[model samples]
Target: MAKTKAAAENESQLADPSVDRKALLSEALRRRIVSMEMAPGAVVDELALSEEFGLSRPPVRELMRQMAAEGYIELEANRAARVSSMNHQSLRNFFLAAPLIYIATTQLAAIHATHAEIDELKAIQQRFREAIEQNDVENRVLYNDQFHLQIGKMAHNPYLMPSLRRILIDHARLGKIFYRHPTTHDMEADLGKAAGQHDQIIDAIARHDAQAAGDIVRAHMDLSRRRMTEYVAPVGVEVPLAF
Candidate 1:
C-alpha cells in the first residue's frame, strides 16, 4: 500500500504544470540567445520576460542570474542584464583564443572520451547535417555549438571546460551571421565538407588519436573563420568615378 501511494505521488508530481515552468523558461531563453533572436548586447528586460513566461519577477531574475553566470549575458551594477556582446575587441580575442582552446580541449577529448560520448557526438552531427540540408540556419548554428560543447564535456577537464564554454557562446553568435547569409556558389557543398570534418573528428577521438584530433579541430576553426570573414566584408571591384 505504501509503495502504491508513493508511485501515485510521483505521478502527481510529474503531472504538475508549475514544476516545469522554470526549466521551460530557461530553455526558451537559451534557444533565443543561441539562435541570435536575442541579439548580442541587447538589453534583457526582466519584467518583460516575467510576463512572457507567465512567472513572477523573482524567478525571472533568478533565471537571468543563472544565464549570466553561464556566459550567456552580462550583468552590471545599476543596469539591466545585457546579452553577451561581440564587439570588435571581443571578436579579435575570440579569433586569437578559439584555435588554442579548441585544440587543447579536442586533444583531451580524444584522450578521455568514452564510447557513449562519441555516440552522442554522432547523433549531434546527424542533426547538424539535417539542419544544413533543410537550410535551418538557427539549428545549424545551435547543433554546431552542441557538437563542440559535447567534445568539451568529453575532455572532462575542469580548467578547460569553462574556457570552452565561454568560447562557444561567442562562437555560436558569430556563426549565426555565417549561416544566415549563404552566398557561396556551393553553400551545400561547404556544409557537406564541414559535416565530413565532424565525422573525421569523431573517428579520431574514438581512436584516441590526440594529434589527429587537434589537427582536425584546427582545420575546422579555420573553415569557420574563413566563412565568417567572407560575410564580414565581401570583396568587390572598385569603380572609378569621374572627377
Candidate 2:
C-alpha cells in the first residue's frame, strides 16, 4: 500500500519538530476551502480532520471554531461543521460590501502602515508574483489572500479588520472560479494586471498616499469583478450574468 501525495506531505510535516501543527492545519483547511476542494456548504467532519491531521479532538475543534469565526465554516449544535454557503443573497451582500471595505481598509492602511509592515507586504507580494508566474492556482489564491490580509493588519482598524477577513473568505472561494480552469487570454491579461496592481498598492501604502491606495484598490476590485464576471458568463454565452 502506497501513501498518497497528500498523505506523504502530511507525514513529512508531522515529522518536522519545528513545525507548528496547528498553524499547518489551519493553513491546509484554508487552502482547501479557498481552492474549492471543500466546496461551499460541504460538511467538515471533526473526527476525520482529527485523524487526517494527526491532531487531537481539542485542537481540531479549536481550529474549527477559529475557522467559523473567520467565515470559512458554519457550526451548529449536534451537526458537523460546514463551509460557508454562497448563494444569491450572500453573493449580493458580498458585492455590495467588498469594494467599500477594500477601499476603506486600503486607505486606512496607507495612513497607519509601519515600515516593517510594508516590508512584510513586499515579501508576500513576491510570493504572489511567483505563484502567478508558476500558474499554481491554489498558491495564487492563497498568497493573494495573504497579501490582502497583511494590508488589513496594516489598516489597524478594529471595526474594519473583521469585515475584511470575512469578505476575503468569499473572495478566495469565488476566486477559484476566476483563477482556475479559465485559460482565456483575458484571464491571463487580468492576472498580469492584478500582480502589477499589487505592486502599485504596496507603493501607495509605502508612500502613505491614502488617496492613491484607495484608487488603486478600486481598480483592483474592478479587475476582480470583471474577471469573475467573464468566467461566469463567457463571450460565447447569449446572456452574460453580471457579478
Candidate 3:
C-alpha cells in the first residue's frame, strides 16, 4: 500500500496536463522539422495535423501559426505552409542569438535550481542516457529538451524562460537535421559526445558552481557549432534542401 501510494503521488507532481499538452505539440513539430520528417521546404498539411492530433483546425492552425511566427515555418504565397529552410545567413543569425541567452539562463539556474529540481534533472539525464543507448533519435530529442527546460524553469526568472524555450526550439530543429548527414568523422552521427556533455553540465549544477555551469554550456554550444559546420551553407546562400 505504501509503494502504491508513493507511485501515485509521484505521478501527480509531473507537469500540468495543459502545459504538457502544449509542450507536446510544440516539441513534436520542432523535432519533426529538424529531422526532416516534416522536411524543409515541404508544405505542412494542416488538415493532416489536425486529424492526427484529433484537434480541430482552429487550435491546430493557431499552433502552426505560432510556430511559423517563430521562424520555424514558411507560409507560401498561396497560403500553404512548410518548414523554413535556413541558409547560411539565417542559420548564422540563429546560432548567434542562442549562446548569449542560453548561458545566462543556465547560470541563473545553477544559482537557483533547488535540490529537488537537481534530482529531477538527474532522472531526466538517466532517461537521456537510455535513449542514447537505444539510438532513439526522436525520443532522445524530447528528453534532451526535458533536461534543459527543467533547468530553465529552476532559474526562477519568468522572463528568461520564454527566451530559453525559443532557443531550444530552434536548436532542436538544427541539431536533429544536422545529424542526419553529420560530419564524416562521426560517420554514424551518434550524439554520444553531446549527451556526455549533459552529464558534465549536470555535475557542475549539482556542485552549484555557477561559473562552471556557464562554461560547460559554452562548451556544449561550441561543440554543436563544430558538428554543424559541415552542413552550413556559404554566407548569403540558401539551400533548397537539407538532409
Model 1 Cα shift for residue 63 (angstroms): 2.2
* lDDT of each residue in 1-243, candidate 2, tens digit only: 987565578789989888888888898888778778888999998898888677899999998998898899999998879999988788879988999999999999999999999999999999998988888887888889899999999999999989999999999888777678547787788889989999999999999999999999999998887776666676784666796
| TM-score of every prediction relative to native | 0.87, 0.86, 0.73
Query: Global lDDT for candidate 1?
Result: 0.86
Give one digit per residue, the lDDT tens place, for model 1 in 29-119: 7777877888999998888777655679898888888889888999999998999998888888999999999999999999999999999
Total clashes in model 2, counting residue pairs 3 or more apart in sequence or in different chains: 0
For candidate 2, what is the TM-score? 0.86
Worst 10 residues of 3 by lDDT: 6-15
Which candidate number would show the highest TM-score if scored against the true structure? 1
CA lDDT of every candidate: 0.86, 0.88, 0.74
Q: Point out the higher-scoring one by TM-score: 1 or 3.
A: 1
Error (Å) of candidate 3 at residue 184 is 6.8
What value of lDDT does candidate 3 attain over all alpha carbons? Answer: 0.74
- How many collisions between residues are there in candidate 1? 0
